[model samples]
Target: MTDLKHLFFSLGLEQLDLSEKEKNIINAFIEQSTPRFNDICHQRQDKEPLALLLGYMTQQHHIASSRWIEQQTAYHQMQSVFQSSVGTEHASKFINQDVDEYILITLLWLLVQGANKIDYSYANEQAETLLAHIHEETKESNDSKEDEQLRQRLMQAFYQGKKTTQQSLFTKLKRMFRLTQQQ
Candidate 1:
């Protein structure tokens, strides 16, 4: 496993002081969210839904927009480093490196946006619920979580929903699935 502390520090997210359980949750989230994120990026459709979700997380006050931007830039730099290092090697080498960094960056960003505060309600309920919504909206899975999605949707789905109301990280997730529900 990646040393969680070093990963966070590299990404400038060490201040979050996440517990072991919290680190596990973030790790699980990254594993579950990766395919969904990649699917959205590959679909060649509008990425606004996920982009909005990312914007909300990366822009949170505690995250410090400037620092987040810098970290994000650093992530890209890491990606470039991985790509250059694996020019003639097996593609998996570069992919694994990039994915690790991606997960770390994403976990840090999510934490800064208050992911750790999510109620999760049941034993692992919150994390799974959150993952299901992303998969549903991104069309990565058929499994559903209607109640969770509805509560999140209505909470965030108001006037100027996209333009004015800044949503919590999880609520902003409702945006991704809700838009797909209409299609």
Candidate 2:
């Protein structure tokens, strides 16, 4: 699987650049704290907190389509945890190190997935779940003019890259033929 940075470069497309304000508030903190996160994740001491840090950074980035990216990434990280536990699948087992390595790998996946311009549908599904957690703040968040603007920005970024899901003409005809035969 492609690593996180590579995923971002390809999928995020126009969302990677941080603005001056974002640079001041979020980018600075991530730049300062990433090494600490890397250490914790590497050491296998506590991965959750580190994952949260990475998640927040991803959401705040200009993914253009979804702000819930951090949570989605988190979900994927958890899924990998399950995958590592059994060690009965197609994955390699590093003896006792499966959990940590898998979680870290999943975290990287989210990072790159944010930068991804493709796979908008998967992002959309995950974004909805994240929005639910902010349900109470929905009115307050969207009521503000600035928040409204951000919503639009996110929609553009995430939606622009989605491939339409229409069925092919041949498939439609085949289905219709089957239905007619049944009648």
**Leading candidate by TM-score:** 2
Candidate 1 is scored at a TM of: 0.25
* Distance from true location, Cα of 7 in model 2, Å: 10
lDDT against the true structure, each candidate: 0.41, 0.41
Q: List the residue pairs that clash in candidate 2.
A: 7-112, 8-112, 8-115, 11-115, 11-116, 11-117, 12-115, 12-116, 64-154, 65-158
Candidate 2 regions with alpha-carbon error over 4 angstroms: 1-19, 37-111, 114-118, 130-132, 138-149, 155-183
lDDT of 2 at 96: 25
- Over 7-88, each residue of candidate 1 has an lDDT whose tens digit, in order, gives 2333334344455755565566555555555555457456544343344434432233334334545655665676577653
Given candidate 2, what's the lDDT at residue 22? Answer: 39
Q: What TM-score would every model get versus the actual structure?
A: 0.25, 0.32
Cα misplacement distance, residue 156 of candidate 1 (Å): 21
